[model samples]
Target: MILETSVVPRDSAEPCADRLVLGEHVLGVADGATKKPWDTGPDGAELAEAVAGHLAATAAGCPAREAVDGATALVRGLLGDAGVGSAVSFCVLHLGRREIWRVGEGRVLLDGLPVPPRPSGERIVAEARALVLRRHLADDVPEATLRADDPGRAAVQELLRALVGLRNRPDPRYGYGALDGQDVPDLFVEVVPVPGGVREVVITTDGYPEPAPTLAEAERLLAQRLARDPLMLDPPETKGKRPAANSFDDRAYLRVAL
Candidate 1:
């Protein structure tokens, strides 16, 4: 098998929260959720690394569900009593079977089209952010300037918190699934057979747009989009917190060809 991988951090100074592990017979990718200010324990990067390492170590022998459950338990134990939760979008590929185990927000492309387990959280956050922005549009604040320190941004964050809280309830319209140091009921695992001798798989974090054909193409398209609409304010894509820079999310892309 041939593997091509790429990872980019949102902030140059901070570590990337996405992790990739290629083992003897298993491949794993994990994207940690951004840490909140009030949260405690290790940061997103640390959590993602831990999860990826666990998956790589266990994927060769254990069932995908077991590996994910074990990793979640380990991380939860590490985070003891802090209300701050460490969440991640995780994927494990068993090379021999051409099977995939996916939990949360990452993408898996068999050939070019996305497989099961599409994302569900960011849209809720984006809608809340748009509502906040629309209410405060009269202030004429540039999206780039909407920092956490700013009052407007703070309000948006508050709304986001509320929205997230509501969504996390027992039975909500949208369930934003993640490896959130908790038991996840919506885990996705499937066997994917290659069609007509096609044997390529692309797995990625949500940072890359879905339409791009290849990782390099995704990067190029992202760069062009950021140049045109840095904040996604002119033509919004789901609507979320305004980014400080053009690319404000940690990104990871892994392609495996057999």
Candidate 2:
């Protein structure tokens, strides 16, 4: 298996705050969103890379689950008080199989197949803090349950819709409930199998698409590129999100070839 990373910063001088690591059995990336328009910096990505690198170093020496748990804890510790957090997305490729743990809105393309949705309640609450503020309601808060009608699912979908709709319209006096004025990150994890006959896997942040691209399209494109020129699979300057003054968010990605 092989791992490659590519990022497009919001500005020329801003360092890409995206990070990734490729373990013998796992590979992943973390993208930190910058709230300030012209500010380019690293937030949780650094912590994520550190933890992922540690997992990679010990993958063969330990159980994959244990390694992943350890890495997660390490990253959590690193971001404890940095005032920097992230939307976490990770994929582990195990013995001819892959599984993903996803927190936020990142994408995972497996053998060209899209990762299935995993409900995230805490993450929804976190976003509410960022968007709604004093207007955020208790009913709006996400409940920690996996099934539908779950408070978390409802809160997240509503909050996200409001965010997308309100992004283009700025109003300083926005109101939300409980978590009125605070910052929070989107997070998730993804896993992929790297058994023989597998082609490729792609992971990317939400900023790359208006409405996220279909899994089939991503798979077809990646497969075709690999067949025509494998080297292009890991190009020096890969296609990334183009920067704009009013861009919704930053974009980042990781590509694994097997």
Candidate 3:
């Protein structure tokens, strides 16, 4: 049974780049990567919606690898290589198997214990960006400046560019995976067991670094964090909330009680 669900865009004026699917014997949340306004590619929202649809139609007994492959092939067929770096991260719960399949970066908790994310240089990368944010804050930059026009992004432009290039690459160390119309290495796909006696499962996008079991607590924590660090640089590794935005990134949540 589902206890709660939410899919909200960071900027209400724009389309949400995240998706939630409550499917037969399957539940999922897909967080789409946001692109620069000038970038030319399929919109993240469109890709996420397509993925959600694919997963919903997928048979419950399908293997994890097969599901990922089919999704990848679907995207590749539609967009070809042009959308190589445009990607979406997903977390799915298969009730039939009592398992969870995840790809790319997001947050998931079974009974409040985190399922470790696939390894990457995420920590160091976030630290680098956070350092830039600190420098800007020291200069007395306004919150609006940080939100509307993040000048610090230029400082980490090279790193961000490299991250995009590494998407769906095969290299185990520095490479990562996403539903980006590229071949995803097995190392990047994860299968987590939903063991017995797990009373609750909470899944969310990276927008919420910490996943709370209930929607109320989660919202309270989010509000507290936004007040404390609107730029999302305190702990690092997140895109900052835009001016007039509720959160730094698109957020989706799904909670189930077994």
- lDDT per residue (tens digit) for residues 118-187 in model 2: 4333233344433332233334542212111223233445554444232212232331111001222222
- At residue 165, give the lDDT of candidate 3: 79
TM-scores for all candidates? 0.82, 0.48, 0.94
CA RMSD of all predictions: 3.4, 14.1, 1.7
Residue-by-residue lDDT tens digits, candidate 1, 127-243: 555556655556787555543333433545664565345322333345555555656553333334545465787888777655254778878977876677554444443333335
Evaluate all candidate structures by whole-model CA lDDT and list the values in order: 0.64, 0.42, 0.81
Q: Arrange candidates, best lDDT first.
A: 3, 1, 2
Query: Best candidate, TM-score-wise?
Result: 3
- Summed backbone clashes in each candidate are 1, 32, 0
Candidate 3 residue runs with Cα over 4 Å from true position: 82-85
Q: Which window of ten consecutive residues has the lowest lDDT sum in model 1?
A: 163-172
Which one is best on lDDT?
3
Residue-by-residue lDDT tens digits, candidate 3, 1-258: 998999878889999989997788789798888875444567788888999889877796798899899888877766667445467788899888888889987788899888878877655667787888888879898777877887666577777777777777777777778888887789888899899989889888887777788878888898899888888887885478777888888889999987
